[model samples]
Target: MDLSMMIEAVVVLSSGLRLTLTLTILALATGFVISVPLAFVRAFARPALSLSVLAYTYVFRGTPMLVQLFLVYYGLGQIEAVRTSIFWVVLRDPFWCALLTFSLNSAAHTTEILCRGLQSVPKGMTEAAATLGLKRFQIARLVTFPIALRISLPAYGNEVVSMIKGSSLASTVTLLEVTGMARQMVSTTFAPYEIFIVAGAIYLLLTSVVVKAIRFLERHLATDGSRRQRRGSRLAPALPDAGVTTP
Candidate 1:
């Protein structure tokens, strides 16, 4: 292993870090926004609505992300209507094409993760809320969604990590992300082993940071729940003596 070559790879690869992070963050943010409503539709809406969401998720999840990227970046341009359309300007850009593909793919997986979280909410809790006269939307907003979000956090974190790694695929569309830079350098220097190892290390570091953040969030949520429970216990009214007789 050439030590200097490895160091150079790190520096070169670092140039692409911003693009890599940009793609990952934007894709995840957009996906989360899109998935939240879709998840609700999938989990709580009528069969017609739910099945539509299910089909969307199924197609994206069933296909390889690389194929999706190719379809968006290459296949779309093949259509005369697409080329003549107002959206052509945005679709023609490789960066936007990659981002669109990644966001849709992430949204599909996130919808399923959130749907499972929503379904896992205890029936009794929602029922109790209803018995207290809470409206459906209010119960979902105040009780169900919050709990479901916490339940979904760990799984969502895994998705975040996956997106970080998957962002490397953007290189296929000529986006100069980390892996793209690594490939460029390898072609010039004929040192794939060193460059790729550095790229792998960068991905590992990003994932490690995500995992640590997820664990911290889980612990914080647990602490908050315990505190709320203790506060509730303290605020409860004291019962009158059980053995006391009425005058």
Candidate 2:
């Protein structure tokens, strides 16, 4: 491997880092907002609502993300109605189309992960909140969402990482993200190995930061209160059973 070539590749790829990060961040943020409502509907809504949510998630999750990107960027333009509609202006731009596709794809997966978290919330916790005169929405807002979000953090973190890597597909739409720039360099230099290695390293670094952040948040928001419980247990006295007879 040529050291100079690798270093040069890194610098060139770094230029596209801004676009890559923008795609990843925007996709994940939009997906997160959309997922929450979809998750809520999937978990607690009527059968029709649940089925609709399920179908949406099913189709998006089942399909390849690359196909989704193509469909949004190229497929949408082929429709007569789309070409004439107000959305045509937005869809005509490859960047917006890529963003829209990525957001929807990420939202589908995030919704399912969140639904799993919601389902994992202990039933007793919600019941106790109800007993305290809280309405359904209040209980869900105060109890369910917080706990479920913590439960979902690890999975959501993975989703964020996935989106970061997946954003490389934006190059197919002329987005010129890191992978895009790498490909451009490779075309000129005919050196795929060094260029790709640099691109992969950048992705690894981004994912590592995401994993550490998620771990920190998980530790900070731990709901088990295990440390406090252990301390109290050690300090408290153990009393004899009231019903036990004297030996």
Candidate 3:
């Protein structure tokens, strides 16, 4: 690409990047905070007890987020009741609609990931906690959720990264996010290739930042203590053995 065109592309794409990153972080944070309790209920409660959470996760995960966004932004606008509702003031804009869709999308996947994490925890640990005089709620709060989070973090990291990419869908709803900006630049300059390449690069750069931050977080929250203790216990000789090395 020519230098002038490249510079123009970067300027436009950078502007879009700011909005993309902001929405991505806001959506993911909201999803993560909400998903834990949803997951807990899904994991431990009876089917009847957890019906709402289950249905919520099922509906969100099953549907395309683009469809959900459109339904919220465009579909809702068609409804007189929705227009009359207090929420209409906010939903009249596409930004909040995109935010709601992205947040709910991540929440569904996060709930599933955390549910798997909860299942991975051994039943013996819960029993032990109970024997130690821990109440049901106390055991769940103090032990289950933390352990489940640690176990599911890697998967959750992937979900978060996916969320960053998914935020591109926001443009479909008329939001001036990265993809929208790229399309606008293409239409204006008739240089689709240059504008798209630059916009794609901006998205790549933003996604890379997310991945690096998650890696830093994973390291900071590493469960070395439990793993090391488990390994040590395994390596320790259960009974005297001539072949065993002394440490």
Candidate 4:
């Protein structure tokens, strides 16, 4: 590989980093907000309400994201009703379409992950909270949601990584994100190998940072007793003997 060409590839690809990060962050943030309520419904609501959530998750999760992107970006404009609707102003833009599609897709997966986490919370814990005179909403807010979020963190971390990778699909919709920039460079440089390597490395670096952050968060959120024990263990050797008198 030519050193100059490789350096050029890095700089060019870096230009698209903002767009990639924007898409990923917006999608994950929106999806998470939407999923929280849907997840609660799926976990505890009667089948009448839960069945709709189930159907939504199944449709989005079962289908290809790329196809969803195309449908939103290309297919939506084709319908006269869609074209004439007030929403068309936003739908006509590729960025909005990609964002909408990615957000919905992320919401689907997140709902299921959160639902599982909520379901996994021990029934005894909720019963204990109830017996203490906590209201249903209070128990859910003070006891249940926090535990479920902690339990879901690892799986949710994976979803974050997946969203970062999946944002590359935005390239298909005319968005010049990192992968799109690489493709554009390859067209001119005729060096797909080098250009794509840089792109993949960038993605790997992003995901690694996310993984480390998630691990740090996991440690930070550990139970107070566990955190204290771990801290004590680390500090034990540094302390002078408790019973030893100074010379």
Candidate 5:
């Protein structure tokens, strides 16, 4: 491998990093917004509402994101209603289609993560809140969501990293993201090995940042737990064991 050529390839790929980050940020932000309500439905809503969200999550999670991107980008254009509607302007662009697909796919996975967290929240905690005269909404907002969010943080971080890697699929729809730029550079330079390694390194760096950030957040939250345990230990009295007398 020529070191100079590899450096050039890295430079070119860096130019596309903005688009890559754009897709990842927008998709994750939209997905988080969408997942909150759906997760609530899955965790606490009525059967009818929960089942609808379950079906949505099942289909999106079951299918490949690439196929979903294709359907949104190409299939939508084929429909008469889509062609004539105001949304046509948005759907006509590859960027928006990719965003829509990525957002929906991320939302599906995020819903499952958050739903599991919500379900894992101890029933006694909420009951105790109610015993203190907290309203349903107040209990959920104050007691349930805070605990569930802490439980889900690690999984949500994984989802963010996955979306960062998955954003490469945006290349298929003609968006020149990092992987897309690398593919273009390889086609021109006829050196796929060097170009792809650089691309992989960039993704690795991005995921490392995400992992470290999540770990920091986890440790930050753990401090509170440690303090509570210490406080409880200080106030609680020690118990004595009965000694047996032998004849």
Candidate 6:
């Protein structure tokens, strides 16, 4: 590739990086909002509610994000009422549609991750919270969520890394994000390997940042002491009548 092509590719990819980060942050932040409540619901709700969430998770997780993005963008365009309504203003933009799809997709995964964290909590804590006159919501808000979060940090970090990479799919819907710009550069410069390598490097950088952030959170939570006990404790299976006692 010529130096001019390299310069142009850098400029375009830099412009694209902003949209990529925007989509990543918007999806992750909003997905966390959806995930926290859904995690609680999955942990404490009846079988029907839990089953419904399981189904929702299956649909989002099992499908390719590319299909979901198309369904949100082009499928919504097919409705005459949607086209004529105020919602059309937002839906007409691929950016908004991609954001909606990514957010919903991440939410499903985070719900499952946080739900497992909640399950890891020893049963004693919930009963102790109840004896202290804590309401269900209060227990969840003050105690359960914080502990579950600390427990789930590693999994959630993986989700964030996945999210950064997933935002590249937004390019298929006409948003000129990093991967999109890379493809545009490739088409014009006939340097597919160069542009693809650059794009891959950018994704690697993003994933590394996510890993560091999760490590920071792990240290912060460990400062509370309970996390150490939780970490060190062996999760042995229940015994029928062996009379074994945990020290």
Give the candidate number with the greatest lDDT: 1
Candidate topping TM-score:
1
lDDT of 2 by residue, 59-104 (tens): 9999999999998988988899999999999999988998999999
The lDDT of each candidate is: 0.97, 0.94, 0.87, 0.96, 0.95, 0.88
> Candidate 1's residue-wise lDDT over 177-219, tens digit each?
9999999999999999999999999999999999999999999
Candidate 5 has its poorest 10 consecutive residues by lDDT at 238-247
Best-to-worst order by TM-score is 1, 5, 2, 4, 3, 6
Local lDDT at 7 for model 1: 97
Backbone collisions counted per model: 0, 0, 0, 0, 0, 0
lDDT of 3 by residue, 87-148 (tens): 99888878888998898899999999999999999999999999999999999999888888
What residue runs in model 1 are displaced by over 4 Å at the alpha carbon?
A: none
Model 5 lDDT tens row, 39-141: 9999999999999999999999999999999999999999999999999999999999999999999999999999999999999999999999999989988
> Model 4, 1-247: lDDT tens per residue?
7778889999999999999999999999999999999999999999999999999999999999999999999999999999999999999999999999999999999999999999999999999999999999999999888889999999999999999999999999889999999999999989998889999999999999999999999988886649789989988877688899998
Which RMSD values do the candidates have, in order?
Answer: 1.0, 3.3, 4.5, 6.7, 4.3, 6.8
| Candidate 4 wrongly placed segments (more than 4 Å) | 223-247
TM per prediction: 0.97, 0.91, 0.86, 0.90, 0.92, 0.86
* lDDT of residue 75 for candidate 1: 98
Winner on TM-score (1 vs 6)? 1
Clashing pairs in 4: none
* Regions of model 2 farther than 4 Å from truth: 227-247
* Model 6 Cα lDDT, one tens digit per residue, 121-165: 878888899999999889888888887888898899999999999
